[model samples]
Target: MSLTAFLHSRHGRGFSCRAEIEAHHAAAFRRFRARVMPRSPFYRGMADLPLKALPRMDKARLMANFSAINTCGIDHDAAMQVAIRAETSRDFRPLIGKVSVGLSTGTSGQRGLFLATPRERRLWAAIMLGCYWPELWRRQRVAFFMRADNALYRSLSNPLVRFAFFDLLSPFEDHLARLADLDPSVLIAPARILAMLAERQAAGGLALSPRRVISVAETLSPEDAALIERAFGTRVHQVYQATEGVLAMTCRLGHLHLNERWLRIDRDVIDAASGAFCPVIHDFTRESLPILNYRLDDVLIPDPDPCPCGCASQRIARIEGREDDVLWWPSVTGPRMVASEAIRTAIACLPQPLRDYRVVQQGRMLHLWLDAAAPGAEPALRTSLAGLARRLGAEPPALVFHRGLPPETDAKRRRIRVLPEARTGV
Candidate 1:
């Protein structure tokens, strides 16, 4: 990657208005489309076709037609083998030649393999630093805690930027010790892990003052965000990313703005009343694996007001979890899909705040998992959930409460999920 080009693209020009940002996105998309149409078999006949007219692609489709979808002639099975090896051995450095392979945690019901060239990795690093790090040139220490490590993530580590990765699968005590020693200026982790660290910070178990705390890989609840902010005396910023790419990051004004300069997004509005939509993304920065109009399952709420930061990029009000996480129940007429926000609101109305919790629906059974920290809070939780069911005008499923729920082996936490078998109709 050209350092000059990366710096110029990120910092040289500014979008004074939304029109200018849209124009930039249009140009980028055109360039990307022109480049990929002839090279990718999947897009071979889509030269002059409109984006909407093109068949929408999803995780399963992408994986099934991986070779045809990707411009690089990497075999899907070979890439999957490399990704699996990295996951089993916890070593993410082995590349398919120059291409880096990383595996998704399969939280969305299917595992995904992401490939990126060395240049693409550098560009990604630049974009991340440009968006999140205010003092880009200043020497700083960064602590990134996640389920898996990747060569792409390690590319950001340098003499000036001290980057350390803490594996979530490791013992909690081990992470605490390492965190205290590293004393990172920028701390990034899943919302749940950040909350745990905040509890330790409040109790004086950990002694570090990170300038910026970024939440990723999990939903950031308002309760958890407030606690983290109070503990660190800093706002808990967010990075909305997945195995596909870095989709958005919080601006200086704390609004999560889509990376429109590098990505073209087509919103598939699900709820017009609530300004909620699912994003169909086309990432122009990725070369090895071309992501064109790939629709994600996650739902996003758009901000009505403009961001104060003066960047005309589209701003997301909030991430409302995945469509799959929405619980389905039998209704008088048809299957009733319960929104995640309603469930979250019901849980938040409890008398006591839960340290961590998850709601899973399986075959007319609702399994509630609460951390041991919130003792005796289950009664209130149950009451609130029952109230939600009553308000929805549906029969409440059997509720099963499990105290002291253990964390998953991976860092990706699904606070709300619906089992595949139970997903069939009301």
Candidate 2:
């Protein structure tokens, strides 16, 4: 199964055309209707219903109906207790039978609970190892940096592979010595953490060679990717995963293609003009915990052009952060979801060599933070943004500028975010 799934990920291996993809979906759903749907209490009598007819699910709704939705008879409250204990104690060894329970960091409001059976764990390991594993012949070390650890991740361990878990809760500096000793052949971490390590490498404070560097969990920006490449002298690969599942993964050509082998994604287009939308995923692979008609808050911009890698799955140009991260400015068409790239371009074209920045919108005010080479950056950024607003046919918000960047934390770094819901109508 591992080898087959691994081969399926390669271009022209799993899905060659739209028709083939549709056929795979048809078969998978057929199996689900016959074998899987009957077991789920939440979806008990809904086997004959089409996907659209099924209840639309989000994190909140899933959690509310967790006990009934899951095929396994695991109680939601019992699973939550186990997950919380493991998190607080920093011990990932515990499990409920063969099923592994873990918590989501919840960049959104409430923390989410996820469960995976042994079969699920093996499949996950197969896809990850098959795609990102550096060398199979020789024993290689894998450095996995995550907010929390779980048996779900431990499936990657074997005699030929030494999986090292780097807890994000600990000080970043303290892990340097261990990292040096491990000198892992495959390095995986959040985008910011990878960038931080890249910075260290550039500064000559760290010296280690890795065959693969994978950015996981959070959004990996173009600038940061370039920085990582320059520092490591290797192309940076990305794994677009959420608690929902491994939604997408970068191909050999470095283009992100939705994991259509395991998932059926339906885009809920938020902005018709920009073609940005959140993914409503139906993962036929996840049976222990069914994730059907589930909408994730992430907003992804689609790439219309075909990938050279030849994977017929949907191509993601970039993840434009969460829905809350999108700022809706007043436009002729009412509240328009402003293209974040436009704002980034405005700041990028600035004459100053700005190192970093943050943009957060609160009510009618746009708070801009600049870590620039010169104090003159504030006025320059303001003018650029005003021009952008004019070009987009939108009204410029009150620009409140601040010098320097926000303090670094373990939290996922979101470049642009909307603090409150914007008034859509004038």
Candidate 3:
């Protein structure tokens, strides 16, 4: 497609009504289902079944059945070998036929490979640019920072769009220097890295005025967003992307809206009171590896009210960490699941400002690594956690405090984590 045509298709000038959005989603999903079911061994069995009746797929099942699950006919071992080599050498130019291979950060304890065809890569670029860049015709530069790179991300590099991938594994000073030299108009990175850059910008160590700043890969905490916006003097936007596909992005009004035009979300509610759910995504645009009724481990709080931006997509109030982060404590009846918010709220209510933190639950013990900006914060944190335990109708877990949290690996940071062995009522 020509640049002008692609822009027009994404902008969807005539797709303003809610009904129009629904119809478009339904049509796209039907077309995708029809095209992939016959080709994909994993999906072929459910070709004649309704989507709701089909068995739900998770990361473990998908990884185990990788070769059969994908319609691309690429062997699982071959894809993994290519993906791992790319990560090790930092050379992502290799591809399996026309399909690009990339690895998931394995934030949920298992690394998975994702495949995207050359055509699918271009489609992804269009959807991303349509969502984030209002002026598609204008020339702009984008700096994307992530642990790994692939052809799918590099496909956006063209005359109209100057795309540069910054390796997160490189030294911090090196990244800062390169970023200053590039002086990109659009900055995209994990929320943690963005927060660090905001600090650098505040200290006059970095010089750049990006028109658009997007948070990707990691959860964008409210604190991180506020800091980034304050430092850059621009609203901090976000892309709710995963290995699955581009699921959502922030609208012009700065609200996170689901990309329901190309993907459908089936909410698996984890907590009813706060409206937290694990989104089961059905992506219509991903043909290489068909993602149908794929359940994600992350938890999100859905917003029921319509967005003022007039976009018909569903809105999300916030992403409440991952389901693995939920604390499972023993209850009178059985092991009860405590929402991550409960622990986060306890820490946020502390007298001192928390610079960074990590909470891990092991059996009846809770380990906390807190970096507080003010003195007398540790005692306050302990007291708050005790209150949280009482509120949940459980005895307070034994607390252990560390001087500092360990540095995170390639995986996305999880402020709260519940050990796998921890039994839960669910």
Candidate 2 lDDT trough over 10 residues, lowest sum: 417-426
Q: Judge candidate 2 at residue 272 and give its lDDT.
A: 88
Q: lDDT values of the candidates?
A: 0.80, 0.87, 0.81
Question: How much does each candidate deviate from the true structure in C-alpha RMSD?
Answer: 3.5, 1.7, 3.1
For residue 204, give model 2's deviation from the true position in Å.
0.9
Q: Which ranges in model 1 have alpha carbons more than 4 Å from their true place?
A: 1-18, 328-337, 351-358, 362-413
Q: Give the Cα error of residue 29 in candidate 3, in Å.
A: 3.0
Q: What is the alpha-carbon lDDT for the whole of candidate 1?
A: 0.80
- How many residue pairs clash in all the candidates, one count each? 1, 0, 0
Sorted by lDDT, highest first, which candidate order results? 2, 3, 1
Ranking by TM-score: 2, 3, 1
lDDT of 2 by residue, 237-302 (tens): 999999999999988878898989898999999988878999999999899888889999899999
TM-scores, all candidates, are 0.85, 0.96, 0.88
TM-score of 1: 0.85
Better by TM-score, candidate 2 or 1: 2
Which ten contiguous residues of candidate 1 have the minimum total lDDT?
Answer: 5-14
In model 2, pairs of residues that clash are none
